[model samples]
Target chain A: MTEFIPPGTRFHALPSPFPCKRGGALHGARVAYETWGALDADAGNAILIVTGLSPDAHAAANEANPAPGWWEAMIGPGKPIDTDRWFVVCVNSLGSCKGSTGPASINPASGELYRLDFPELSIEDGARAAVDVVRALGVEQLACVIGNSMGGMTALAVLLLHPGIARSHINISGSAQALPFSIAIRSLQREAIRLDPRWNGGHYDNEAYPESGMRMARKLGVITYRSALEWDGRFGRVRLDSDQADDDPFGLEFQVESYLEGHARRFVRFFDPNCYLYLSRSMDWFDLAEYGDGDVLAGLASIRVDKALAIGANTDILFPVQQQQQVADGLRAGGADARFIGLESPQGHDAFLVDFERFGPAVRGFLDEL
Target chain B: MTEFIPPGTRFHALPSPFPCKRGGALHGARVAYETWGALDADAGNAILIVTGLSPDAHAAANEANPAPGWWEAMIGPGKPIDTDRWFVVCVNSLGSCKGSTGPASINPASGELYRLDFPELSIEDGARAAVDVVRALGVEQLACVIGNSMGGMTALAVLLLHPGIARSHINISGSAQALPFSIAIRSLQREAIRLDPRWNGGHYDNEAYPESGMRMARKLGVITYRSALEWDGRFGRVRLDSDQADDDPFGLEFQVESYLEGHARRFVRFFDPNCYLYLSRSMDWFDLAEYGDGDVLAGLASIRVDKALAIGANTDILFPVQQQQQVADGLRAGGADARFIGLESPQGHDAFLVDFERFGPAVRGFLDEL
Candidate 1:
């Protein structure tokens, strides 16, 4: 029997043969998730929150920890998400490393880590996994569903693949299809991990982590997540204090180098290299039009949600504001009351995470209306 | 006794003990150079051209190799540079591998490849080496000095360090100093090279090249050199035909991936990783403010050139058009005849090389006036 743990919650296993989008099946797969507030008697007040590539399921704070969550500022009683009014469910992505069913998880048949043997994943798979968790909890219909970055793509997939799962939707910093520039960037990142000698063809021992490759890949990712405009204003051309006895040309001289290093180092502590490889590829392969017989508007039409909100950062090159506008336009054309909000930000694709002041109010307004 | 090669000719060595900007000098250092057209009476019509990080001394087609040069379409008889009217000389930058004294060159003292032992190079060192070559050829004064990308930075340094060597300057797609974003990108690239176990601290045998690392770095470089606008227009979300028997997430699915792979492969065939490291760092270390004791305008004032031209591409994120405008403004404020021209392009930082039609006209107009 699954224990009903309070907020800062633990995970529960999904039934066997979890269907994946591409082909292979996941046996006895599980999803790690967290929750806040109480589910209504009718089980109609649940809000499912999906996350980006790196964030965990800890989207909001709980009484057990009380220290604050990743989105604590905007997810409290009076905040945009309003935990007092709505039961928020945040799921750790299926292909992620945070206690989720991923390449790092043990395979039931072989009794060993799946590694590269893990089924090829897609955004649709992630969305379906979240829906499975929701249904397992005896929820007939969700009040709303929200997603950011990778989550945004998954949320759209969930609505398209399983219609009427939620009454409303919120997609943030995501695209209808992966742009070539983004695909190229992610491809280089995978190459960085795979080229590392220690990767060992995805069979590396736990002790022999692909540290250098993972760090390099994370560094590149950080560069893309944020904007050059922000870096210029923050670090500029200022030199950092160094300990080198002689001038090392390749040494960390600029403050920006130090900033990138700090971020990359922090990421390597939690993220798995193989999981990064798999999840990044899944995001690159995502295309909403695939579900509608190569017609994006048709796919949008398939989403039966009553309302939708599409939020974008003007400076986001990964998922440009234009793509977000397309999401809003597509949904509106498909008979859903959709609203698009383009926020001016120097934070680029990361603005949704960093600029909660502007984001929170917009989200609150959208949710209150629903 | 030096060989007197004709116009459209081959290389000649710069004298030994090539003086560098910071501390120790390069021993037995030599520069490879190519020329077009005849040096006129009094040698007053010579034009010096400096290239970017990758290009060699072969800026235009010559008698030796009838095949066109990298900039052949823009540097011939009736082209922007007009070889028939002015003697044009293109030198391989110091610390570059193409027929120049670089990490790939043998060290006179150790009798082995200099590799990392190659002294930390600076843009000023590149300028000085080019000046030495010009002096060796009996040229008293250059009619103009032209630089593109890395060359542009070197051209500025030449004017600041050796004020009266050239009468005019054309700075294209280059910056007065490295921006934070660029520094971060370059730092990650260097990490990619260092992280490769095959690099062996720059001591790897020729046969055991760090091919994967170099290819990864080049791929990242290619992505940054071009813009997302161009990639979106060219490749979009079209999938390339793949031979994978089963669904592989890491498969080459996008045409953009193929394009990047092709470019990376071609670059790895010619570029030395160590040389790339040195030159990339040299660019990061460059700052015009240092020349004038921390005053950029003061440094610009030190350039005793008759006139200057600063051309920037609209889509260039590496060295932005705003930075180029600053260059023009600084020169004009410093009592020099300076003009700034912003060209619309989807090619980004590479516009100077790829969109020669737009670039050629601007350069020709600037040179014709001078």
Candidate 2:
């Protein structure tokens, strides 16, 4: 369960002795990526797409791997990303278990899972790795860089740390910094995994996985991913039929509870707990304010781009709509034509993933002009 | 850690074979309560206070116990409850581990902890037990019955099931029925506990207690008790000193994380895990809609009361302000002069407990006229 690499995934060998931002280095390290369409001779129509915590490099169905990808609806020939016109490259985050060099990956020197031996991961580190993938693909400058959720933070870092990497940017449900409420949620999720007896200090194997802890963490994440209004409209007070005569009095009673159980079980079975821990902590540690003399806006302003569009759902609580507004303002302060769009979708932080009607047109409009 | 009873707590032995609403009966069960001030002749000046999932019967310092109670600020000689004018009784919830008959209490027949053997507890059961204690105190009818958090649910149940039990009512941060969002949150809390291996199907002793599980549950509760606004104002991403050079990369980094850990550790040591599960489930199971054809407003309208006051903070996410407005509206539909007051306190669900400046006057303003 440590790594879940999809077929047809390509790899970029990072420079030998790749140094981590917080310290430590890895030898013979590599990052996974996948691209759709051919890069133009001038490499002016290339776009790099970074993702949230879980997704692999395979974002959309491709000829090499016909299976529908995580964002199949949003990333196809005629989809929002429009592979027919633009060469789109998606990199699996460096700290993710999805075919990336992370805590779940085997250390080349020791031939053992990095696990606790992995250096502390930060959003900046993943940003650097994504840049390496883009450069190796022979693209000196990307037409646009699109990032969502955690990827949004990494994309901003990519632009801030390595200026002129992309001509334009699209941030969906992103933030300039992690807020207290979000930190609390992520901190609790990490504790759930760490406290599980089966975690055993990150030594659990596939047969005896930290299923319970992972389930709890994923359940919490799912709850926050959507808005309460959506929950009320979808589940309401509907009771599960199984709740009527269940022997375990504390078992699932509502349809919502059953939904969470099903969703969590499906996710935790494939995702590695140690990798999840490393990535979750990295997000909590990410604050753009560090680059701005203790000001988030200044940090955001430091990232330069020719044009940008920041879109978010009004119902997003984890990365609230206000943060997107801030992202636009900060980039605009840096002289970029950063337009902000707050969609009236009830999907909360995950609106960009499901509410394509609003996000698609906004992303398409921004890229079409370029 | 099964039960933590404060000294000087008094008990009222229930009628043999006291029945529970869900099913089963207690052979020689009793409820714990503590009174402040003296009961006036005819018991016309009596007031009963029902609390949330936690808290003991001692609502304020009394002659028998000089120590401060959880609601020490809100109830005293010159305070909102004003013990000098009205005799106050606070009953520890029946399903609680605090000096009351619950999963932690020993069964009369088997002389073993009730644990899972305890009948399914509903809000109606705790309401019935509170009413019995009120009757035993020589109060034919209470002048006012105040309920806060879970207590608010019990208070409404008291008025609904036992029609003349109390003349007036006050519901603070309570709900008419459990919302899907709240249910999801509680469901995760319960799963965190049940997943702990040390819980051992509810058979673990104090030495093998589910401390990790309890810690997780308490931390989740603490996060929701206050609002994001308050967290931002109070902690604001402030880091703890210990987090600076901590060897554990996943350990506490923010002040908010430290606050939760310290708060959770203190609570898990005293609160019994089984009692927590029972009480938490009871709150989720309660729905006044059961009395009114699946319509929460109709269910609330069935309750009879002379006067009422519903108070809540605008920031409350667990029990949002809209629920209080509904309580007021439903009680008004039943012909009671129910006044709804939404306070501008950042404390959220726990505003009634901490923001005394706003709540004290609201409670006193309603009571002084009565």
Candidate 3:
């Protein structure tokens, strides 16, 4: 289980230029990614697993860490994203912190962290950066591009912005247009961060971080990530402690409170607050139909991918099944080979992460057919 | 629109001793409330409107303020509550700040705000306080007792704890037991206040108030008060000052953000951080079944109220319609005259506040029949 990655595995860094939709260019932007398995001479065997919001290039099994990768259980040697077959590449998105050129990366001219000065990013730029990373690796074509949530939106954007880059795509729990409800929720979280006095307009340097604000933001995320039914079933009105008198003391009172705190603490450590702000704003700004004259089907028609798989969770209130239906319907009307699956899972939008028994097989079947 | 209270209109403060379920006594406990119309000489024409969480005694029509009371539109002269005929008493529950004995009120023994030292409260205690208030008012019986949300729960508790108090009951958007999901949301809000450094374990006196914490709590409340669809339809992803360049150095970027700030600011001014914590915990600890050998229906059966009306919101994910149905079923099984109405409103659990046209008539019709 703790086997190490073969020394033959190669890592690459590609400095790419992304033409942002905001009428500005982000130059000297490099995407760092890793490659496993072997790239066929024609590079047609390449498969890309676009990372989710905050995930980096490390999408494959890493023996040194022993702990499985974010989706390790599904992307290992014998897993759905079989490393033994496809030449897999997972690139850190453009405006991310994991070895990618993001807010934390030094500004070329200012010689300081970009901080608030980082160019505003869009999903188009994120997809464009992935294309550059792939091109730098000398891959002319991809077998399939798979992503979840934000990554899913980026995968679709790639097909629309750069046609024929991938033969097939998998979109999990994502929408073609940013839902107003989703935007509202994200806006509240961003406001929470901005309201923190310590944020200092995103200029807080090596000082006390806006931990409280970040915690609130994560708390909001926790609410959206899972279903209300799940929370009730798991923690309900149960007291955090055995002593009824001390159950709701001046501190953490419920099991769910402690659970949310743990989530916030871990997220604050691994996630850059500035990057979170930028990425969330990018998602909020995403509107495929707007780019295509208010026609969602027309926007999807621009994609020339041969095959696509759109998956949704039944209990996903954030990105509900209707959103996925729109994506599938648009792709079908665009004359693209598309299939949609609405998985019945009580876990809500996060079912993709928790319901691996179903998701694993679906991914495996999609990849095998492709 | 602007008028003074008529010459004959009168107001009174009713104080009563409420016994706690956990033993001992909450002696100085009082239910501060006001009344409109006139009670029959036999004191049988009284209608009790239990105020919701955080609401004060100002639940009925008041001419001095010019603006309508919380339920003024429905409970005025010749209105649904028919103040022209029945005496309506709106009592501020115990552990509340609006003219009632709460954390802000001086502890009889300490001569200071109870603060964190305030004894834990439950919905039963709130109902008991209502009973005391009613008894102290020299009212032998209630024609009808109506409540919404927390108040609804309190009304049900009153029926169970003190039989023959109200001949008829109307519970809107409340549950016999606080669901786990609701408790989880409340726990997060409470944690937000406790985590604030200024909270000082709820002992923060007149010093820097936990404004940030309270703001976060209000933001959390806003999330549950309305549906995601409602927020998106109302605010969407529209920016506050879209014309302003990202380089603009000041102000919120999105309208939703500004909306949330305004809500937070208003909530912080009127709501006490500690009182919010106490009231929220009271709701979380509410479990009628817990007091009745873990039998919720049996507990409801213990109530001997005559006619009962349980109204629920279709979009209320917090206290879903199922909870209301359960209450109605319990009442019906107990041989009580009960009816359930599931109102169609997309305003979530707070629909009772905004959808006055439908709710107003339904409430009025019920009261008229009583």
Candidate 4:
């Protein structure tokens, strides 16, 4: 069973023998998504959300799921997204483990798990998979396309590949292309998993899982996800109790280390390591500059939409606020009424998920005006 | 045998069973050092240089070891730290594997490698060991004590523990205490090293060394040592040739990733993993606040020095510029003529090592005034 899925989940059958952007094809491919609220009579009130690296299609609670979601605070009746007025569709990334056709899924031809045999994936492929869901739902044009983190890149890809698919866009903590620093981080994460002997060339079973590698990768991600200011504010020179320290000299001693350990342990079992490697590598390979003859801004300018808002945190070292500014500038250059908002949230790249007090109104204000 | 030691290296034997800051003691412990120029009859021109984690006693070439040193550009006949004008002594940090008593050193008591059995190390222990070397060298007081990176913390400890041991101080990219951000980075690095099966509870022999762990740790260190801005400028969206990409799905693709790989490969075998773990943890455990009633500033105020200069790079995320500023302000609060200088170098924490054009003048100007 997929980890953390909504009961309302629906699968959209992708084109048979679907080809990936980076060469290679998947047979019997599909995408998973969940909806909140009903599409208007004319299918004019639909909004689509693409998530960050780790999230699934479940963005908020619904009568079918009856469970709070990754973005529960932002997407509910009368919430900032306002499910009452706007019908929302959230799709799980194509290369993700949560209810999506990724390396963990069975290869229809072989009747075995895809694992490393899965085709090389790109951000464009995820965007294409998402586009299929929207087209299949009978939504002629989306009211808005909202993307967070990696999803922000996917949103731009959607707007660029299919011009009239989305009326507007909201890019949260996203970039036009991957930065070298980001690429290095993802590379290290992939290395952590690969170096683990238990990974066994991506052939590990649950009993022989690469727990350490996944844990290290998760810890590294958690470290970059939040800002140093937040770490200091949350756990400044705070040592763990002696009982928790254990005898191992290298064991968790600080509160921040323990927090990371807990986070990594919780995530290691839930997410498949091979799936993580593929999704992470896809982000590293995403380059909008490829579309505009080595100009990221030009590539973004090619994305046509009615309006766009690129929002990011000031402390975001991963995607960085500069990228958001670039996204807005390029969208504006392309004739869309685009704007960039940088919040002084100390939470870094994950601010969108946790700093609701600041992000909520900005999202609501943008949607209310639209 | 020690990995890399200069022919000019000299050993200073400490008192038998020397006590550590936290508990336990080391027997038959010795400090390694190298000298440049001759000490004046009055010993008034003596300068002591304490290094960061990886550097050895060989800061510059001498007659016995004329090979170019790690800081070849900075400390020479008429360079910024002019050996022609001052008698300089560079000491390898105590817990490091560079010709110093560390986890890699044999325990005289048991006639076995200290390894995991080595006593817990602290920055203060390194500081005390350096003081012993200075005292044995017949210098009642040093004209200046210069510390870089982790050395910055050691230099502060030198002044705090043994007041008036040095007349002036130079703290480069150093912090009075470890920040939660720094602790998290180091904690992750240690985890990388310890998780490797080859580590084998720190029982690794030369043949079965934890090369992967060390490589991963070194890569993480390199990532933090340099700035993201530098990475973007140096390898922005640059891909390796197809031949170099190889067939591995998660293999190195970007120039930055290759650079890190080459660097990690070069460093992994050079430094012992156990020694790396101990020294890294020492920095994380160091806190000036321990000396000052739960206040870092108060702790700095307690250290008595005639003058101090805390210089750092603006882009240094590891030992951030704010930390150097705090060091200066704290020293000033303690009645020292301390000042802070934040350089506009793009090299991050390693600015002192690479951006000699910028750092040379500042260091020269400070010592010239003295």
Candidate 5:
């Protein structure tokens, strides 16, 4: 798996004994990444795009695969962060189940799946891995680093830990730390997976997977990602008319139930349950204030970035707009040129994914300034 | 079970062949009820109190058990809905496990647990049963009927389906119909119960209960019942210090996680999983407009009540204040004296349970006018 890098993707091994934040070390740890466009001679035109929880390295379509990537709309030839003008590199997170080495990875020493033996992950660790990938590409510094959700926290981690590596940082719908509401939501998601008897202490037989738990967790994720207003607009009280009035009342009788079930079923097939558990825990444990010596402002003020942008959605409940405003305030107090933009969309925490028209201009203008 | 009627509690069998809204009939359906105070000479001083998804008929401390009930703060000698001046009747919902004939009950014909064989339930069915209990107490008409959450929906159903049974109705955090957002949430809750392997298609062995699923469902419910603002104020980012730093990253590490776990564990002991599934589906399918041929205003117009109160919490996300305003508007359009009052509190959908100071006076005032 490590020897043959795909045409559009590359793999790089981190330095020996990469120390994880939660007191674990990995040997021969590798990162999978994809790049679009060309790097300048100075290598300063590179733009690193960090992803949220589930996205992989395939950020956009390429000659090798015509299938659109997760951020296909925003990373094309003529889109925001246009490939024609900048070299865009997207790396799969360290504890992700995609091409990256995560909980599903094999332990070199034991010749078994890491599974629960995998080190506890944190946003800082993901940030460190991304920086290693950037350095391996012979890029001394990045022109900008863009992050969405979990990626947003990782970008902030990069600014605090490896300052001066990225001249500009864009944090979208991420917070300084996980709030109680977000923590509670994630706690239930993990419990759903752990409580499944099929899980068997994270060593379940592959044939009988914990699909039920994963599906339930994904259903919850999809619900929280969008606002109630968005659900009302997309699917009102319309019943699933296929079921007659005589059908079981507990069956999926609403259109929203079918919609949630459809998405959750698809998610269970591709995502690894253990990776989800690990990554979600990592997000909850990440506290930028911990790095800043117990003060949120001190932690944010410690960032040495030159320019930054904090974007939030007005209807986002997961990471409310108030947190985004705090990010901009902290960045400004830290002496960085930071601009705050709040998008008015019912898309909620998912505004960045669907509201490209509003987000595209903001990214384009910010990049133009740099 | 019917032989012993606790001091203040009684059981009333509904009229033979009780017809359910969703095309089903119960041959010997019974509702358990508790009453506070005595009826007047004319037998008109009755206040029927309907309950939320949980909670039993024990709404307040009575002669038998001195222990304060769920709403002990707001219902007593001189509290709101004062027992000294008016008769108060509290009934367990039609599909509940607390003394009411529900899924856990043995079918008269089958001689076994009704389980999934129980008829589908609706707000109208619960409302009709409560009215029957009130009539069994020899009260021809009720002075007021008050409901909270699902109980709120039942209150509306009482107004629409059985007009003139109550002269006044108080709806707290209830909507005319379930929204897609709420439907989606309830669907997931039911899925949690049914997906559990122990559920065994709603026929699990009595010894091996589907506690995990029920616990997970209750955890989700407790989280949604409160607001993010309230969670932030109550739990914040406090870590579970009981666990060492080396504790499993996936373990319950936040104060909110512990709180939810404690509540969920207690809930699993008292609430039956199948009853939870059936009632949640009922709430999702209930539509007041369906009672009036799909016209919400017409449904409200069908109510013969003289006065109404629609109460909502400002921070409630499940049933927003906007929906309560619509309730007031629809009732007013029907020529009823309806008042819409939005309580300012972080309690969210559960404000009625805790904000007695704010909710108490409103209920008292509404009944006084009637």
Candidate 6:
């Protein structure tokens, strides 16, 4: 038996009216979200966990379908998130595949999948949708908003774009502006997808999916998500199999290669190719300073959040410790209660997911202070 | 004016009997090399400079073709290599394109280019070719054998394989064994070449070459050659052209991508795809312990080098600082006067090429002791 939402549980769909950059007037674009636990009569004690690039409202608790939520370990009873003490809400991000108005979602007018006709989505747009989800849940304000990776970036965006949405924010292993190296890497990944023969300019319905392209993209990502020293220490010169001779061409020659291949294969099965492109482009276009007249501190000043915790991993070359320092400095200059934690973890940018023993305690401490 | 190597300078084609791993034998497979300055009466002033994977015997002196030698800055008149005093010799290794017996060389049996039929060449074979070059120069012992990257690995191999060939060794960012991550990255580069439709199983003729695959390989190599931090700092989110908006479909969007593309394009023109594959494979197969019952120290014990300098760069993730430490540790354990120097440079593995101000002093200081 699995846990289920009570029959009387309230769900809301709040639509927005904003003209997209691609000349599409998006009307009645409602966000779908689910709330767990009780919101105090004063609409306080609410915690919002923003979902990642492709996840949905089912990001905390495992439902009757029983698919493990992305953050199942952190959100359940006695977990760091502790839904019993606070009302937790998560929404399907804009331009996502899972029940969101993405490329795969059907258009109301034509009754056809939006496909390549979808509007370009920005981080601001995604954050706006998240705000709508909270407002529709009858919550005037959130105690805190926490997110990881891209979701972390979105949490920062929520603070900047939506006034007084959250009292505090937790940004884990993310940056306000995507770095140039990241943009370059993501450009190559996008090229891989666009170069695929089956892509046909993102209109491949009856043909095979761009799997080879997706695999290449995932391989590039694996290189960024972990430290070279970690890879060398864990798998230096190690063969995939002990029994195979050096001359065997088809055998698993290197352990790191085998690990990358496994990750690439799994990512291809679960991820959408077009969504990957859109989200990568969104990340590249994100520059908070640019929006605030090239002053990052001014952008932080615009955010109404009372406090912030900027967390980074020492080995995370993708989102380095320096970037976290920049965020903390900017927030402090803006008179916000900002602190930074540079954790020593060899798992690189993915440390937030792997080093939960340390991360869970840090999150609990931050939330306890609130 | 650039000084040139005068025509009619005496050169030697030293062909040694090298044993191949896959049975059979190759005789008179000469290593072509050039020498500058005078070998002392006792032939004790000889300094051997081992070239990296793609470079040839023209390591210092300018050629008639107007293209500068790869190490011209370091090996010329008053430079670190100092051809004015030290008798500097550089050889085209066993499996190379310039006047060496590589895949393009003629096969003895069929009198045709070996091509795909070429034997798998190991780092040991490359070192043996260098040894043959040294012997042919009439020098009984080398004052020093200096190398960078793959060439550094070859220098280590020489010390282990032929003890009396060199009295001192300088390894610039080298590793005794290729890490699994390195092998995996190199394997993908090789596969990028092999999977190209134009590769034709390495049988592509002179007219038709795998330009796309070679470009991809170079693109991948460029990423490893430079640090992500450097890339971001130098070309952060800057568009190649200001006129192009964020939504532009064609042309490079970021400056880093353009830089990588430029590097890849230039590399394809001067470098052979087949040679890149063979050399990377040679690097992947480099493991000193494989020759001495799986004991790396035991293998290096045969080397009679008096002093060894293992140098590394701070930002070099490809051949990192720890790798240089491994070289120093191995040589020290083998009773050699080993010293480790970790240079702080932001140029990544290519720091040895660009950071000549620091590299010059380090090299001169090490050689001054001799």
Model 2 agreement with the true structure over A141-207: per-residue lDDT tens digits: 9999999999999989999998999999999998878888899999999999988878989999988
Q: Regarding DockQ, does 2 or 6 come out ahead?
A: 2
| Top-lDDT structure, candidate number | 4
Mind giving the per-residue lDDT tens digits that candidate 3 earns over A1-370? 0112222333344443455778666667677677767888888889887766777676756543344567776777888888788888887777887767777777776887787788888888888888877888788789998878888888888888887899998889888877666776776677677777777787764466777778888877877878877877887666666553344465566677677777888876566778788888888778778756777667776677888889978878778877778777788777878889998877888888878888889889999887
- B115, model 1: CA deviation in Å? 1.3
Q: Of 1 and 4, which scores higher on lDDT? A: 4
* Per-residue lDDT of B357 in model 1: 78
lDDT of 4 by residue, A1-370 (tens): 1344557778999998889988999898889898999999999999999999899898988877878889999998989999999999999999888888999998998998898899998999999999999989999899999999999999999898888998899999999999898999889999999999999998998899999999989999998899999988899999999988858778989998999989998899999899899999989888888888889888887888989999999999899999999999999988899999999999999999999999999999999998
Model 1 chain B: worst 10 consecutive residues (lDDT sum): B1-10
State each model's CA lDDT, in order: 0.83, 0.90, 0.76, 0.91, 0.85, 0.73
**Which order, best to worst by TM-score?**
4, 2, 5, 1, 6, 3
Ranking by lDDT: 4, 2, 5, 1, 3, 6
**CAPRI-style quality class for the chain A–B interface of candidate 2:** high
Better of 3 and 4 by DockQ: 4
The count of residue-pair clashes in candidate 1 stands at 0
State candidate 2's TM-score: 0.97
Native contact fraction, candidates in order: 0.97, 0.87, 0.47, 0.79, 0.91, 0.46
- What DockQ do you compute for every candidate structure? 0.84, 0.83, 0.47, 0.87, 0.87, 0.48
Estimated TM-score per prediction?
A: 0.94, 0.97, 0.90, 0.99, 0.96, 0.90
Candidate 6 wrongly placed segments (more than 4 Å): A1-17, A21-36, A51-58, A107-115, A242-251, B1-17, B22-32, B63-66, B106-113, B205-208, B243-251, B291-302
Q: Pick by TM-score: which candidate is best?
A: 4
Question: lDDT: which is higher, 1 or 5?
Answer: 5
Interface RMSD over true interface Cα atoms for each candidate:
0.8, 0.7, 2.5, 0.7, 0.7, 2.2
* Model 4 CAPRI rating: high
Clash pairs for candidate 3: none
